[model samples]
Structures are given as structure tokens and as C-alpha cells.
Target: MDDDEHLLWQRVLAGDDDAFAAVFDLHASRVHRQARRLVEARADAEDVTAMVFFEAWRRRRSVRIVNGSVIGWLLVTTTNVARNRERSRIRYEGLLRKVRVETVPDHADEVLDSFMRPAVRGRVREAFDGLSTRDQEILALCVLEELAPADVARLLHVPAGTVRMRLSRAKSRLRAALGEDHGRSTLAGLGGTS
Candidate 1:
């Protein structure tokens, strides 16, 4: 297996598009899964996955392969990509906080606000953001994505029972964050019909 991978990598080094695609096909899912563990949204995870592969190609010469697998390097790249995005998000939020709005109320704004309910959304977002990374990940996988506990367990490499327990606890904490009454309905919505 190691020899096959090494040969394929050598082909990649020689500018074989097919070999590069083969490598991506072999590792894309694993890279995406790792990215999802660090990011909150599915879209962001997908972005990170793409960025990881892009980086792998761009820095192909520097990628380390151990035991015939480049997965370790891919995972490390995923972590760096996710952290960079998080830092960017933080800086953007800080910039938003610094900006002051002093516009007069408009009828169109009122109409949009009436239906959009930005306040409620903000509250829910704030509550969700307050959770620890593990809790957030569990909620994102099981609740937001509506993935089965067993599937999440497999992806996370944890027992199904542990996934269930962590999900329960995470839900409870989300409730605490949003206040019980509001949290119950919101959790159901966020978690879907599962």
C-alpha cells in the first residue's frame, strides 16, 4: 500500500492531473470530516476541505507522508485552515462591533425586521456560540445537520452511547444558554424533527 501511494505521489510530483485527482478522491472525505469537526457550519467545512486540497497541491513538495499515508499532513492542514477562518471571523465581528449605526428608521427596514426577527436570531446565535467547541460540534453534527447519532459516532470515532449522552448534555446546555422555555422550541427547530 505504501509503495502504491509513493508511486502515485511521484506521479503527482510529475504533474499528473489524474494522480492528483486520485489522491483527492482517496482523501477528500476524511479531510472534509476533519474540517467539519472544527467548523460550525457545513458550508464552512466544505470551504475548508477545498482549501486543504488546494494547499496540498500548492505545497505538494512539503507534505509529509508517514507509513504510506498523507492523511496526517492533510489533517494538520485542515486544522490550520479552520483556525485561520475562525480568526478572520473574530476580526470581522470586532470590526462590526466598532461600527456605529445611526440611520433613521425606514418603512422597508421595519417590514424586513418584522419577518426576519433579527433579535431572536441574534440571541440564538449568541447562545450557540457560547457553547464549548465539543458541544458546538456535537450540536452541529447531530442537531443542525440532522445526522444520526450512530453516524456521528462513527465520524467522531466515539461510541454511539457516548454520542447520545454528549448530545443530551449539549442540548441541555443550549437550553440553559437560551433560557428553558425559548430553548425548547428553538432546539426543536435547530435540531429538526429528529
Candidate 2:
């Protein structure tokens, strides 16, 4: 949204590879961070981040800088990439289990467990698990990935009004599950609240 980003976007759209590289350099770290938060795995996050940029390059012509910022688009793309990776991982793990393969690492559970406090994380996970798949995806795209409703709509191929409506419903459900006070405190604890 800054002047530099606007200039870079203009040059990139005008077929300047250097401008595209500059934009990648500036945004890649943030994209990776968002992916990491959503997927909760460094390797998966890295893969998702790479895929996000790859998609950006593929869709470069269609990307617009309407609000002078490409960040919202980037975040939404990263969220989708992360979700895809997670789904694939889940399916692979299920297959492994069905095949009677040893899918568990000795330290894997412990490592993931250490990512959050037991009580707060448990409650949040419960809340997330209760939501419909659509609700979960929107919540991750908007709240976790920090994409605006319009950007989320663009990424998910939905209308902006639908995004707004879904987001409102998702928030209401999450709030009801966590309770208003506990939800605010837990979000603050997760560093998601301002």
C-alpha cells in the first residue's frame, strides 16, 4: 500500500521481472510466517510459501493492485496453500495408518504439544473442531491469515458479501464456544489480539 509497493506493482504488471523479484523479496518472509501459523509445521509452511509465490507468478497478469496493496492477496493465497498441504498430510497419514506403517515419531506429539499451553490450546482446538469446514476455512483465511473480506472472497471464489456473512457467523460461533471473556483472553494469549 505504500508508494514503493505501488511502484513495484506497476512495474511488475508492466512485465518487469526485477520488480516482481523485489516484491517477492519484500513479502516472502511475511507469507512464510502466515503459512507457519496456519500449518504449525516449519517444513509444511516453507512448502506452502513456495507454492504461494509460484501461484502468484502463474497468475501475475490477473493480480490487481486495486487498493495499492498486494498483501491481502498474498495472505489469502498462503492460507489456501497451507490448507491444501494440511489436507494432503492428513490423507497421507490416514493411508499410512491403514497400511499398518509406523507413522508416529517419538517426539512429534511432544513437539506439537509444546506449541501452546495445554488448557488454552485445548479449548481453542475444541472450538475450531466444532466449526464446519467452511467456517474453519474462512476463520483461518480472515483471522489467522489477516486477509480482508474482499481478498478472502477473491481467493475462495466467493462473493465479498458472502465472505462478510460467513465471517460474522464464524466469529459468533467461536465466541459462543470460547465465551466472550475467555475468547478475548485466549486470543490475546495467542498474540492474535491487538
Judging by TM-score against the true structure, name the best candidate. 1
Candidate 1: misplaced stretches above 4 Å? 104-194
Q: Tell me the deviation in Å of residue 22 in model 2.
A: 0.8
Listed in order, each prediction's TM-score against the native is: 0.53, 0.48
lDDT of 2 at 28: 94
Local error of candidate 2 at residue 122 (angstroms) = 61
Q: Cα lDDT of all candidates, in order?
A: 0.89, 0.83
lDDT of 1 by residue, 4-98 (tens): 88889988888888999999999999999999999999999999999999998999998899888888999999999999999999999999999
lDDT of 2 by residue, 1-194 (tens): 58779888888878798988999999999999999899877887888888998888889877766577788899998988888888998999999889966676699567557745698688899998999999999888888788889999999999999998998788777777999888766655443433
What lDDT score goes with residue 112 in model 2? 50
What is the lDDT, from 0 to 100, of the residue 187 in candidate 2?
58
Q: How accurate is candidate 2 locally (lDDT)?
A: 0.83
- Report clash pairs, candidate 1: none
